[model samples]
Target: MDLYFLGTGAGLPSKRRNVTSIALRLHDERGTFWLIDCGEATQHKILSSPLSLSKLEHIFITHLHGDHIFGLPGLLGSRGFQAGEKPLVIYGPRGLEQFVETTIRLSETHLPYRLWVSVIDGGVIFDDEQMTVTCRQLNHGIPSYGYRFEEKPKRGKLRQTLLQEQGIPAGPIYGKLKEGHDVALDDGRVLRSADYLAPPTPGRVVTILGDTRPCDSAEELAEGADVLVHEATYAASEWERAQNHHHSTATDAARTAANAGVKQLVLTHVSARYDEEGEAKLLADAQAIFPATTLAHDHLIINVPRLPG
Candidate 1:
């Protein structure tokens, strides 16, 4: 899986960065991508990338803030123009449904696809064959949420050599075995998949948070995550302002990443005041606390590698 950062600025857009939007691409795994937050001009940012609106199936909103959702209506409408007719699911706070419905209704827009909007608090919001998603309230000015994307563990490869040596020809039975299901041979021999397959492969975990202060809930939500995407809207020197705004400084984000034992930390939603020089300071400050840190910028892509067997 890979992430494409369509916009990564905080509050508003700047010459150096756009607003907050991210695309989690899973073309190889599921032939689609899940979007996280749709800030202003998010669709425009996607248009500059290789992402396709037709491939976007899910949108996870962190809050109702203008910077986080202003582009949603435009993106939703663009999907129809692109001939996208697949169902789309959106998970967000209470005002999400109303906001989308109001936008579509007022614009008199007709969507050719089904839009499933969920007003979620905190819990497992989505679970499917490949992944399970959970959310927790965050420490923000208003009600905000942090999302945890946990990929489901996959069954190990079937012992093809053993089956071939046993003269068991490969066919639909192999599919059953790969799915961890036992199969009965034509000769009435019961084949146990557990006995033939290796141990289950561990899945990857990714936690993406909205504008928030450094809190224990953030750490809990990111515990052992492979990648923790947190907003570092201020530099360490601006800690007081960050606290007042319920936002995290770069140092704050790094400390949380360290406490969570996350493998990597990607900082986004940066304050527009930070030019390239200030952004360097932000990145360096975070790295000083947690070495595995990177700053996310508009149109930047980060790939999440699979765990080694």
Candidate 2:
């Protein structure tokens, strides 16, 4: 699994950064991509990345803010032009369904694929065999949310060496052993899979929060996450301004990550006021509190590796 940043700026688009949008690439996990947010000109930003509109199966909108949803109509229309027929599902706040329906209806944008729009409040919005996505409301000016993506635990490794030591050769029986089933060989010998199998490998947890201030819900959603993508819309010096806007400063995001025991923190939704040098200071401020912190930029691809047993 990997994460690709399409837009990392907060509020509005800028020369250095666009609005807030993130693509959670799941090619390795499920051969599909789950978009966290689609801000203004998001499709244009995806053109610069290696992502395809056809592979975008799911889109999770944080809020109804114009900056976070202005590109939805364009993206949906372009996906149809690209000949995408796969079913698309969108999970967002109550106003999201109306927004998409109104835009597509008024603009006469015809989508070839079936679209599933769900109004999500707080809870597990999506659950499949491989993973589960949970959402929680955050302390934002509007009704914003955060999503937690967690992969299911994988089966333990097959004890090939142990099987060989026990005079068991690879064959159809090996499949049963790998599936944690008791395999009876042609020679009437029963091989127990538990003896050869190790403990189940733990799954990776990724928490991507929407625009919010320092809140307890953010910490709860990000608890023990392998990667926590939080908003850092202001520098340390702008704490008052951040609070006024119900946004978080770099240090505020870092503190939340530390409290949540997150492994890595990727800060995004940066204010356009900060240039390259200012961004460095924002990164530094977060690193001072949480060492494993990185400031995200447009088109920044992050590889989220599975944890070692």
Candidate 3:
């Protein structure tokens, strides 16, 4: 799976970055893309990339802040213009349904496909065959949330050599065996599927948080995550301001990653006050605390490697 950062700037758009938007690409596993946030101009960002609005099947909004959800209506409307026919599921905090309904009603825009909106507090919001998505409350000004995406474990490939050594011929029976089904041969010999299969492969865990302060709940949501994408809206020197605004500083984000034992950290939602040179310092501050820290840039694509068993 891959994470595509459509916008990384905090509060407002800048010359170097847009507001806040992220796309979780799982086309290889689920044949669909999941969007995290649709900041302003998110549709324009997707226009420049290879992502298609038709393939965007799910959208998870961290909060109702304008910087996080201003572009949602436009993106949803654009999907209709683009002839998208698949159903779209949007998950967010309370008042999300009213927001979408009000926006669509005021704009008089009609969707070509079905749309499902869920305003939830915290729990397993989405669970399918390929993945399960859970949410937890965060320490933000409003009712904000952080999402944890856990991919479901997959079956291992069958060892063809081992099966052949057992005098088993490869055919539809192999397919059944790979699916963990026991089959009896014409000779009345029962074969155990597990004997021919290797160990199951563990799935990747990605935790993407919205605007938040340094809190234990945030760390719990990111525990042992393969990639923890946290918002660093302020520099290390602005600790006081960050704390007052309930936003995380660069150091705060790094500390969260360390405490959670996350493998990698991707910092996003940077304040627009920082210029190109200033961004370097913000990144360095986090990396000093956690080595696997990276600043997410607009349109940056981060491919997360699968976890080992």
Q: Estimate each model's TM-score.
A: 0.96, 0.96, 0.97
- TM-score of model number 1: 0.96
Scored against the true structure, residue 182 in model 1 reaches a CA lDDT of 93
Report clashes for each candidate as comma-separated counts. Answer: 0, 0, 0
Q: Give the winner by TM-score: 1 or 3.
A: 3
lDDT of each: 0.93, 0.92, 0.93
Sliding window of 10 residues with minimal summed lDDT for model 2: 183-192
If ranked by TM-score, best first, what sequence of candidates would result?
3, 2, 1
lDDT of 3 by residue, 1-309 (tens): 999999999998988899999999998998878999999999999999989998888999999999999999999999997756778889999899999999998999999899889887898998988899999999999999999999988888899998888888889999999999998899999889888888889989999999999998899999999999999999999999999998999999999999999999999999999988999999999999999999999889899898557
Q: Model 3 scores what on Cα lDDT?
A: 0.93
Candidate 2: list runs displaced more than 4 Å.
185-190
**Model 1: lDDT of residue 4:** 90
